[model samples]
Target chain A: MDMQPIVRVRKLNAWFGAAHAVKNVSLEVEPHSVTAIIGPSGCGKSTFIRCLNRLHEEVPDARAHGEVFLGDTNIYGEGIDPVVIRRKIGMVFQKPNPFPAASVFDNVAAGLKLAGIRKKALLMERVERSLRHAALWDEVKAKLGSPGMSLSGGQLQRLCIARALAVEPSVLLMDEPTSALDPIATKKIEELIVNLRKEVTIIIVTHNMQQAARISDRTAFLLLGELIEFGATSEIFTVPKEKQTEAYITGKFG
Target chain B: MITFSEIAAQGYTKRKFKNRLMCLLFFVAALVALTPLFSIMGYVFIKGVGSINWSFLTQLPAPVGESGGGMANALVGTCVLIVLASIIGMTSGLATGIYLSEYGRGKLATIIRFSADMLSSVPSIVIGLFVYILIVRPMQSFSALAGGVALGVIMIPTIARSAEELLKLVPASVREAGLALGLPRWKVTIWIVLKGSLSGIITGVMLAIARVAGETAPLLFTALGNRFWSWNLTQPIGSLPVQIFTYSISPFEEWHRQAWAGALVLVLLVFSINLGARFVFRPQISRD
Candidate 1:
């Protein structure tokens, strides 16, 4: 374990109304590493990841208990704006949802504009850079003024990633970013994630064990709102410490 | 195999009656809806075409039984009022809708939604009277501004409720995508949610304009009517519906003819606006 982990979760509990979505689970994410949260459906992996940035607050009855720290800063402390936390910790959702009304250029520039960057030349430069980082620049460079909805599903998802990267956040959260993509797009995004880890810390929630083993340095196994195991990706896949993790990896049960 | 003909005969008789009954019911329902539409068109054209002339449209309203007057000023007033009302109604309604759909979920939003629904159900005449008390009497006179404001009041609830419903139709994933990019709440609503629901909002605005344009009661106590051309917002103005209301009641043949012509123009105007909105806002259905 590193002396100063970038993100630390301690005794974290979450509930959606009366249903406990995330149990008292604790974990740490080292700085500048790709940590994959792997679990089957309804195992609270997504909920757990969402709690890091307080994204669950949008749900009417969603509530959380305990603490989350971003580099020693208590994320849930009083007077701390979730908006600021979210800006620091950007997220990409399960599906590709580019702003339908905006042009490709505008979609990439959205976060920058929100941060009050007004110079058009600077915005264009950053948008191009982010698009290139997301591996979408070549195909969309000529048609940056076109509506984002005109892009293919795979392209739109990458555009979303570019939009996320445009704001230059410290931590990037991806919730099944490639689940809706085809094999080729998924491979490209996986490659992008590997490249992105050099510059930004990443927390990815994926169901594909192969993907987690291929890209993540560390992996966390969650089941039914409880953290079953957390360790190096190779150990979690090959020699899990817990029987539940072993059984899950061996296709015994989700 | 043993008695195929007899089985066929039994099945055919049982199904034949039900099929005929269903066809008859469907035919009657279709007729019930189509008859009034066709008859109204027929009646309007038959009576209105006689008065549809350059003079009838360009001249001013004459005395009670006299003929040879135009509805040009009334038509212009109606256009200006409806356009202004639509602008006010759409902007305020869309803002209220975004607040309700995006930022609101608690008691205040619930109350606003409830009031909006209640207001939509209130009679146009009641809205007119309310505007009269609040606006007309306060100003101590009826004016086009008062009329447009009253029409805007009637329009706001309809547009706001429809826009809110449209905004609700947008999937939450779209909002999540914008938020995940660290976009602020207002930016997400304006850039994503509002854009996604733009077509639906336009439809609602157009429908609101159509509803208000045909209303005479609201304008009765507000704009009143002008005998000659008047462009001033602070003075009484002539409009199609109020003109139709006044002309339809007179016993003179010429006034009756002019009323029919005005009604035709009003219907045509509403129909064209609706058609234009549908043409502009309906999503493109590309083959690819």
Candidate 2:
């Protein structure tokens, strides 16, 4: 609890053309902890996480005017590469996006291969390790040669997680990774996330309140592009300071 | 008076009858649409396939009144022309397509896109005349190079627009996934976005090639046809389409038969290219 934060944001704002999406949001994520971002739909929770890796600016009209620090370095400083920044902060999407044309082994090894790791032995080792970390090794080991898209939805999601993990990133950002999953699959991913928290700082944007409460140590509530409250997960649930937060948590209104 | 149920049943029967009648009408319309196409194929196969043999493929056109001959020079020239044109076309087309789909914005992309669409609709004969004045006249000769350049010019707009549309089908998420891996934007575009739509791009390329295979108007002015086997690209060259036009209009019946044989070869060449492309893409299509 006393550890220094691995990621910090100060007055971060995102704009999609003329429309402001994330306005002056700031938070800190300590290493080896899971911080859940909770919000209703269209609340900029997804946009906020996207900014952490500088991915929000991919759209031609989308721009970010804010400071995000990974470790001690500001990611948007002059000559700082977004590609390099993203390498340290890996991301998993809401819907599973395993490379359709690649094999299961190649999908897990995609990021590593891009980084120029061509040695077969080294690739095999890393792929196996990443798959194990994502808790998908045993299930997919025999089928490593199969096309990545041939897997079930849950397995594809896990393969994506495995792909993200292969690069050995410092922070893992997930945007509602389990929203597309069935209950049993969601439970499995939740369990995997809990197990994964020991090695990296995890920040997850989830609309499911129970999921946030179950998996996160800290929770940040966002509404209409504003961060309304941030607190320890237990206290946020028990003694919410904002009425809007209380209303949202109690299901009185989204 | 009829009961309410009986009235409802009569209405249902009337609607059902209409539906059946409409289905029959659609079938008849479909047959009408397809009959001409099949008849053309049937007629061409019957008339042309007989003249196609090994010697007809390998031998040069018989001297004036002789019986045995082949479009050997034309076949080879068509290949050289198409290959040259494709090389020129694919380079410009793919580069322009990449710019149109991924890079350019504002007024420039719109202008280029509009111009490409307009160029594709221009008549091939007009394009041939334009090529004749611009290239063949300047070069001071009707050469295979000029002919290839003409076809290449025609290929650019079609291939570019097709490539652009196909590249656009690549999901934004795929770009994000590639960029997230720390690869540069251009590398992600070439390796991921372009690779993802490669099959579609190839389909476009094949279609463009096929269209040029049957075009005679462009070659009439640019290549100007040769009587002998000539490999010199800077000199006049024989091409199948031009040969077909020349022989079909000739006074001799034997030349007409040779033209039919040449037409058969051209059709088979195009058909095989399309079939070969489909064969190559089967594994790609099997993927989810």
Candidate 3:
């Protein structure tokens, strides 16, 4: 692990009213590296990532108490704007949700447009770059004027990826990005995620264990809102330290 | 025992007969529902279309003993009242909807939601009487402004609730997606949430407008029915419903015919509005 990780978490805790959703856990994600968080349902993988960018606060009874540092700045610090933090750490959701009101081109351009980027040529270039980055440009380039909803599920997911990347965020949080997609689409997205690591740091939460081994430089195993294991992918997969981790990896129980 | 094929064939025949009977019954029910509307439209067209000339449309109402006058003032008055009322109605209704759906929570939201439901269910005449007390008595004179205020007030709760419901139909995921991109809350609500529900919201607006347009009870006490052409908002103005009411009640036969003509025009106006609303908002449904 690098001494100065791009994202560092310390004693992170979250609750949905009385239900503790994310337990006290700490982790660090190095820059331009893929860190996969793998877990079963209700394991707080989504909640943990959402906390990274303050998206978890949108829930009615959801609350987080933790110190999350983006570089040297404590993201959860006083006077730190969550909106600014969100801009810096773009998030893709479990479900592909592109704006139905916006066209394919407009959907990618939406983030930039919201950030007050008015230069038409710059928007065009960035939109193109982002789409290319998500590996969706060639398929959707001809019909960019069509509504984003008109695209296939995979294409829409890729469109969402492009939308997130358009803002040029330093970190990207994806919560089960390919869970809703078919195997072929999932493969495409997996490839895109691998490629995207060269530009932006990525933290992907996926249920597929093979996916973790395939893409992640390092992997964290979360269970019942607690971090059970965090280590290099090869070491964790071949030689497990925790019995629970081994059981989960071997499909003894989820 | 009968063979299996024979039994199956007999059952098929019975089912086909039942299906045809059900289809015929439904057709009859539809005809029964539509008969009154068609007859009323047919009667009005036969009687009123003759009365609806350029002069009848563009001229003032004929006096009690006079002829050759038009509902020109009434037409313009109705338009003005509707235009003013819609502006007042839709703006507040939209705002209320946004609050109710997005910001309204706790006891206040409950009170507001309850208030909206109760207000919409209030009888239009009761609303008229209430408006009379609120505006007409205070103003000391019947004004077009007061009439518009009544209609506008009547529309607010219905529009508010429907728009709120439509806005709620917008998936939370879409809203989350936009906010995740760092868009402001207002932008997420207005540009994304409201825009996504635009067609449905417009449908609500249209339904509310249609509801308020044909109402005579509210306008009876407020606008108070003008006899002459008047544009000033402070003065009483003629409206189609009120004109139809007055003309239909009088002993004068020609006035009765003119009233029928006015009813025809009003029906067409509202019907077309509803029809146009469907067409305008259809693309929204298809997109969804």
Candidate 4:
């Protein structure tokens, strides 16, 4: 509690037309730590994470009102570009989406290359480091020249993680990164998340209770677009203060 | 329990007969659809092959009563007109399509899309007349530049519509992934989404090129069919389709033979273009 939090969200509200998706969510995430958001489907877990990087508003009818502070700067302040904010706070989606037209190596270098970084030496160095950090360097090092979409399903998800990490963001948001993976792939990604916490702060959204318990230092339970409970992962799993949190964690209801 | 014999008695034979009859109908319909394609190709080859000699391809057209000549001037003119049209058509068409699919979501887009659809259905002859009034009258002369602009107008609507459809096929997640990487929306639309659908767009362009290559009506008013060898864009130019049209209508027997040869060459040019497009822009190795 003594160390200053890296990310602080206050009075966050999101809507898709008239449907309010994320309602007044407030939380603080410690630097270089993992925070998991567990909830049932349509409970705003994904929307809450998206709002941190202003990605929630990308949808056609979507809008948000909130203050999200990233290292003392409110990202929603006037004249602040969402493009710049996104570079500082990276995101990984539920499905593994690697650029279909680019090679594995190029996919990892897309963010920098598109931002006008053209030196081959710089791109190669950053791509290698990101791949290593995502723990996919050994599996894909030989096939770096092949199309990114040619990778196996599990490997593609890790490749996506590497793509996100290549930009060197301070905070990483993962929206159901393991939902589309098989059991073994899911386990590997969970391990990767634990390892990644040492380099960057992480906020992960998952419906899997066991995953939140196994990898998170802190947990937030969201239900019907509201924050139901927030606490240390061990206590929330063992002795949740709220009855709804207990019912959800114990599998009585989603 | 009902036995297998009980099931068979329940109109099984009648249902099987109906299925066979429908399959036969579909097969016959397919054959009917293919008849015109094969017949035209076969007829063109049979009548046109004897007229095709090396000299017929290299030498300029001889005077009307003469026997020895070629369509070399027409070939080069066709090439010039195509190059001009491609520049104009591809640039504007691709831009319009990108705008329509990516940023066009209001009344203006609807009006543009509707206008494009109407323009595509307009007859090529009417397009020629419109260009005749717009350019030919103002310039007071038929020139390759005017002809090229006419063909280019015919190409725009086709390319724009196809580009829109092909770009729309790119999955939304792919675009979202680009945005999440901190790339601006325009960069994501152009470098990522547009680049991915490039092969499909090229295929569409090639088809439009082939269609315009065989067009005679638009060039009739603008190019006006030069008999002599010429390369100047401001002067009258000879094109394959126009040359074919002119020679086919003449009373001379020699010109008829040359007309058949020109038709064959034009058909072959279009066929090879289509074949080349497939070879050059084959889709990248994509799993999904």
Candidate 5:
């Protein structure tokens, strides 16, 4: 916990046309740790995480004004390439989207290959290491030539993780990565997230409070596009400082 | 009071009768729709099959009142024109489609989309005249290049519109996935989005080509039809549709028969192109 923060957000505000989505949110993520954002539906949890990688503005009429620092560099600084920032901070979506028509090996190696890396030996090595890190190499090693879409739901999500990890990003942002999964698959993903903490910083957005409490070291609560509470997971669950947080935790209302 | 079993029995009989009636009506409607298509093919086959012999295929057209002749020059000319048209159409059409689907939000894209729709509805004869004024008039003679340009113009709107729709069918998530890998926008579009939609684009291109293959009006003023074999783009050329038109208008009954044969050839060529596109560019739906 003595290392410099991997991601630092300062007074971020985002809007979708005339409607405000994320309002005046600020937080810092420690390196190689898991920070989970929890809230009800439409609380801008997804929007907040998307802003870290500068993907929120991709939507028409959607814009964000903020300063996000990756290590010592502000990602939104003048003349900084959003594409480069995205490579440094990878993302996993709620649905498992493996590039259609691509093989398992190609899916993992796509990032490296598109970046002009042509050496086959290097691509093979990176694809193997990334699949192994995502806990999918054993199940998929024999079927690397198969289409990525042919995998089971859990396996496809893991393949996406492997695809993201192949780029060797410093931070991984996951938006409700396990909501679409069954209990067993969800358990596997939770374990994988915990195991991945030693290699890269992780920020996950989730609606399931139990999932947040189980997999996260620290938790941030958002309500109606505003940050309500931010603290250690144990402290936030057992001793919330805000009344809204206490009500939400005690099953009073969303 | 009626029992439940009695009510169920009554409803079942009524439902069964209704279903059978609807099925019969649908069958009749389908037959009505297919009647014209089948009759045309059957009539053409009966009329043209007798004239399509080896001599008719390999030899040049005979002079008036002669017994037999083949449209060898027209057949080769049609193929050359199609190749030239495809090059022009696919390049411009796909580029326009990519622009419309990927980065088309502003006024320029709107204008381009509107122009494509408008161009698609303009009569082929009009387009022929336009190309004649643009190319043939300047060159001071009808040429195969002008005919190809006319056909290429006719192809662009259909290919562009269908390509845009096909590219749009690719989910936004796929594009986002490519972008998240740090690849530039153009690379993501060309390598990922366009590649995934390739089979559909090929289908669209085939449809456009089929539409222009038998167009005689455009080539009438542009290529002007040639009796002798010619491959030079600067000189007049012969095509199946133009040959058929010229032969059908002649006073000789022999020319009329040969015209029917040319029509048959043109239809077969278009049909085979469609089948070939489906066979070669079929989407890979099977898993390894």
Candidate 6:
């Protein structure tokens, strides 16, 4: 039997006021694999990813017309709460946006707390596990009481990941996770991403082609709000089917 | 070559003269603004320092010409009235500001903002008159409660406008971060937006208090004045501004001297509160 796809996007279109940001995007993400969307800036890579969890619903005059399925259930289906969908599909932003006011422990347990997990021992246990899963446990274990912002940039990004993972989502979405970090921190996060793929389906949007090639199993190239090509990471880099993909990988043009 | 050098020197002298003229204009403007500040301080010190006795601060106002009386009643009453006003003004103002910045958008927020601006510009005497008709007549007496409510009414628009401006200064990215976590909008505002802008909000509240504390017209008809100590909110209370106004207009030498002392005390109190607010709300050094 074929393994089930964790997320499937079909004919997705997103518009920001008068601007059509994403146009006719369709792709399927397999379970337990990293699918990195690669494109130049303003190519709707981020918008496409944001649609996976309906984060764009907050913007005024922002409307998305498409079908996004999360494990055979249409996420945008009627009566499906965006909050509940977000709880199941977590995201990490480009910047390490840990709640600046909250402590490290509270940051990791934020989702659980929102879900009304009030028991101290349960919160502590879940926070520890999530931190361990994000590979941030050893560094932040002793300083869990300290502010989340007190961590190094790379550590803070990982803490954000830990915070997202604490809700135990099936798919983890990362938007340029290590783009803000130094080389060493980027390498650490790349390794963590490789390890995380074993437990959850991972979708990442990144501008760094080399990082996408290194960490992703499949790569999707998007240009001007359209998905130009999708295939195995090696093939997309070495033998792209589309001219736009070749131009992008060889730095000929955005 | 000598003639060329002479021309260059003349050019330099003309430029220097123009620069000096500009500098002199700036200096005059600065000095003109500062003169009243210096004069007030000087006048207060010269007139009131001799009356700054322990008894003057500790004892109630005595008979019209007596030297033993202090502004004790006025001082305590002013503190109570300002505290009550601050509490009412700051809470309601903050809530309204949050509503405007977070939830309000089109016509309703615009109307509220316009009304608040108009309210801030309304004359303080008119505010006093309004309070006199609305609150004092119903209660059938001039009281500290009426005074505080009048001052709070004046302060509300100031505090709300400042708070709204401060809240707007908070970057949208901060709010986005909280919302991205699937937290509700209200939770994000209270737990994140409010915490991030706490210092700016406190500064706005302090500035509003300073503005209301020195107001003389609003309290003229509301609190009126008391000759002795009065704790009843329903009875007349002796705030420093009203006491200064009444005593300064009186012909007695002792009353005039006491007014000067009370004015000095009020100025000092306002100055210290402003300084304390600045110290408390100073930005923290970021580790990054």
Leading candidate by DockQ: 4
A1-254 in candidate 2: lDDT tens per residue?
A: 89888999999999999999999999888899999999899999999999999999988889998889998999977889999998999999988876646789988888888778899999999999999989999999999998887888888889999999889899999999999999988998999999999877899999999999999999999999999999999999999999999999999877
Native-referenced DockQ of model 3 = 0.61
TM-score, ranked from best to worst: 3, 4, 5, 2, 1, 6
Candidate 1 at residue A56, lDDT?
Answer: 86
Give the residue spans of candidate 2 off by over 4 A.
B1-9, B280-288
Candidate 6 deviant stretches above 4 angstroms: A100-106, A109-121, A135-152, B1-32, B284-288
TM-score of chain A of each: 0.97, 0.99, 0.98, 0.98, 0.99, 0.98
Compared with the true structure, model 2 gives a TM-score of: 0.95
lDDT for each residue of candidate 3 in B1-288, tens digit (9 for 90 to 100) = 899999999999999999999999999999999999899889888988877888888889877799779898888889999988899899999999999999888999999999999999999999889889998999899999999999999989989999899888778888888888888888889878888778778888988888888999999999999989898998999999999999999999889889988988898889988997887676532333
Between which residue pairs do clashes occur in model 3? none
- How is the predicted docking of candidate 5 categorized under the CAPRI scheme? medium
lDDT of 5 by residue, B70-105 (tens): 898899889988987888899999999999999999
Candidates arranged by lDDT, highest first: 4, 5, 3, 2, 6, 1
Report RMSD (Å) for each prediction in the order shown.
3.2, 2.1, 1.7, 2.0, 2.1, 3.6
Give the per-residue lDDT digits (tens) of candidate 4, residues B1-288: 999898887778889899999999999999999999889888888888999999888889998667798988998899999988898889988988998998898899999999999999999989988988998999899999889989999999999999999898888888988999999999999888998888889998998899899999999999888887887888889999999999999998888888998999999999998897787676766555
Model 5 chain A: ten consecutive residues of lowest lDDT: A93-102
- Error at B253, model 2, angstroms: 1.5
Question: lDDT tens digits, residues B174-256, model 2?
Answer: 77887777778887788678876787788888888888878889999899999888888889999999998899999988889
Q: Fnat of the models, one by one?
A: 0.49, 0.43, 0.51, 0.63, 0.48, 0.29
* Residue range with the least summed lDDT across 10 consecutive positions in model 2 chain B: B279-288
Off by over 4 Å in 4: B1-21, B280-288
Residue A189 local lDDT, model 1? 95
lDDT of 6 by residue, B1-288 (tens): 579889999999999999999999999999999999999899997888887788878899888556678999999999989988887898888988898888888999999999999999999989999999999999999999999988988889988888888777666755766666777788778877787678878888888899899998989889888878898999999899988998999988888888888888988899988997897686633444
Model 1: colliding residue pairs: B59-B70
Off by over 4 Å in 5: B280-288
Quick one: ranking by DockQ, best first? Answer: 4, 3, 2, 5, 1, 6
